[model samples]
Target: MQAVAIMKQARISPQKARLVADQVRDLPVGRALEILRFSNKKAAQLIKNVLESAIANAEHNEGADIDE
Candidate 1:
């Protein structure tokens, strides 16, 4: 199952957000969070929040194990 969370009208421009997203594409969640935590760009923080929310949705709504 897949859980997706999207943030619209972000303070950051689309171009900048896309750049951050591209960097984490195909990366594992743990690694992606690490990269976002250390990233110099502000967009990283926003993306990280959305990612966390998606994870929560997957766990709570989809009843998926975090270890998976």
Candidate 2:
């Protein structure tokens, strides 16, 4: 099963989001959320929303086990 979620035309720069994304690279979902939650950057908040949406989509549409 597969699912896709996308956020478009966000009012943030790719460079700024990349900084936060790099920190979460290759990390688990829980750990990434923790990092994003504590981050005080605009880009972090945006990226966090996207990540959460992806998780939800995987769970609802794909019936995937998020804790695997």
Candidate 3:
């Protein structure tokens, strides 16, 4: 199953958020969270929150395993 979460009209610009998003693309969820956790950019926290919500949706709603 697949689920999506979106955040609109964020205080940060798209370009800035995209920079952080790009870093996590094609990475495993665990690795992505690790990178975001220690990231220096302000956008990292925002992206991390959104990513965590997405992961929760996938796990609780879709019954997907984190290691999947």
lDDT of 2 by residue, 1-68 (tens): 43467889989888988999999977888999999999999989998998899899999888899886
Q: Rank the candidates by TM-score, best first.
A: 1, 2, 3
Best by TM-score: 1
Query: Which ten contiguous residues of candidate 1 have the minimum total lDDT?
Result: 1-10
- Candidate 2 deviant stretches above 4 angstroms: 1-3
For 1-68, candidate 3 gives per-residue lDDT tens digits of: 45577777678988999999999988888899999999999899999989898988898888889787
Clashes of 3: 0
Candidate 3 TM-score to native? 0.87
Instruction: For candidate 2, list the clashing residue pairs, or say none.
Output: none
TM-score of each: 0.92, 0.88, 0.87
> Given candidate 2, what's the lDDT at residue 65?
91
- What tens digits encode model 1's per-residue C-alpha lDDT throughout 1-68? 57889898789889999999999978888899999999989999999999999899999998988777
In terms of lDDT, the best-performing candidate is: 1
Which of the predicted structures, 1 or 3, would earn the higher lDDT when compared with the native?
Answer: 1
